[model samples]
Target: MDLNQRITAFSNLSLFLKNFLSDATKCEATLNDFEHLKEELQQVIQTANRHNAWFTPEHITQALSSWSAALQKDNLTTWLDAYAITSSSEKRVAVIMAGNLPLVGFHDFLSVLITGHHLVAKLSSDDQLLMPFLARVLIIIEPGFDSKITFTKEKLPQFDAVIATGSNNTARYFEYYFKNKPSIIRKNRNAVAVLTGNETPQQLEALGDDIFGYFGMGCRSVAKLYVPQNYDFDTFFQAMFKQQDVINHHKYANNYDYNKAVYLMSLFPVLDNGFMVLKEDTNFSSPISVVFYERYTDVETLKAELQSKADQIQCIVADDFSDEDVAFGQAQNPKLYDYADGVDTVAFLLKL
Candidate 1:
């Protein structure tokens, strides 16, 4: 299929996903091949919770909604407008996906296909179902895509280039394994929020979404706080209380209880809001149920420190903090053009 055909197929997949958001059981008339794909997708959604507790129905729905919003015809056209996409000799591109959040590696999948490359994806065990199911929808929408997609549990076959995502440790292994090939090896990165002690309650409340969304498992989740020295915790805690319902999740609550007990036993001072814990720490990556916080004496000094350690940061969120800074509540809602780790996936694929 040509570029326009590929775009139309993905846009159709987005429409199929949008139908399932409100009521997956009630098949919509607009869906093509509605009966078969609808039944399969519904079953996947119904059992996703059983496979991974983090894939709660609400979280899965939110992920689907985000993709639906992103896959609009206008959005896709605008994002791809900057690139000169030409049909070329197709090469196989292997993608090693991360399962930290639902559909986390989809951008890579979309990039490879849209750039006229075949995809050989090794699905993360935690997120094995969704992508492949979506692939099936695409194949049905455009039979030409069937030859372009592959999923495997065994060792990956020879491919021209690779894109892999994992922890810093696994990244080193990928770097060595894929050394002979062109690749993008992603490492662990965390997002942080810089609090000036002037944010209104509304902004702080939105920041809570950045911190607690996806139960704070995704890389874009705000894991640390850079606050002015002597910043009071009362306002922050009160604003975060809006998301107190997170504590009801057994997995999150278990972490909160265990981490709190461990901290208390060690005699480390911590601020708790029943659902979340804040501790004075210089580190960027914090444990689940806990957000590390460090006090900054001056904004300029803090900016320099962050610039020096840019590799460890995925996003810096604040009000006009910098050109790259994400606003409160937008950390998890990145647009199509917001490349991860400042690496351009489309450019990488096009070069291959």
Candidate 2:
């Protein structure tokens, strides 16, 4: 199938997903031939929660909603407009997905297929169901996709290129294994918010979404905070209180209790607001239910430091900070063009 056909199929899949957001039963009528798949998708969502405790129904729905918003025809067209999608040589691209969040490696999956290449996806054990199910939906929308997608748990066969996402240690293995092939191997990275102590309560509440969404599991989740020196915690804590409902999830609450116990036992200084913990630390990757913070003496100096450590960061959340920085609460809602790790997946695939 051609680019327009692929885009139309994905756009239809997006519409199908929109119906499944809150109540799949209510939206089943909207589905065309995939009406039967609605019940199946609902079961997958239910089973996903059992397979991965972090994949709560609410979190999975949030992920579905994000994809639904992203896969609009206009959004897809605008994102693909910048790239020349002329390559007809279809190469098999192996994708090793990460399972930190729902559909975490979907962008790569989408990129490989949308670029007219075949995909050999090795699904993350933590996220084994969702993508393959979506692949089925895509095939129903565009039957040609059946021959283009493959999911295997065994060793990947020879392929023209590879895209892998994993922790830093696993990235080393990916680099070594795929040395002969074109590759984009990603490593662990965290997002941080730069606080000027001037944000309104609404902004801070939105910032809470950046911090607590997906229970701070995704790389785009704000794991660290860079606040002005002597910044009062009262306002920040008050604003974040709106997200206290996150603690109601048993998995998140367990992490909160365990991390807090460890901190208290160690006599480490921490600010607690019942649902989450804020601790001063230099690390960007914070434990679940905890947010690490650091004091910045000046914006210029902090900006320079952050720039120097760009490779270690996935996103920077700030207001009027820089053209590259994501706005408060907008980190998780990255657009199609917002390439992860600053690497263009489409460009890489087109070249292959």
Which portions of model 1 show Cα errors greater than 4 Å?
24-30
Pairs clashing in candidate 1? Answer: none
Residue pairs that clash (backbone atoms under 3 angstroms), model 2: none
The number of the candidate with the highest lDDT is 2
Error of 2 at 170 (Å): 0.5
TM-score of each: 0.97, 0.97
Q: Write the residue-wise lDDT of candidate 2 on 1-352 in tens digits.
A: 8899999888888888887665555443245655578788889999999999999988888999999999989999999999888858899999999999999988898899999999999999999999999998888778999999999999998788999999999999999988999999999999999999999998999999999999999999999999999899999999998898998899999999999999999999999999999999998899999999999998889999999999989999988887887888899999999998999999989887
Looking at model 2, residue 1 earns an lDDT score of 85
lDDT of each: 0.90, 0.91
Worst 10 residues of 2 by lDDT: 22-31
Q: Which regions of candidate 2 deviate over 4 angstroms?
A: 22-31
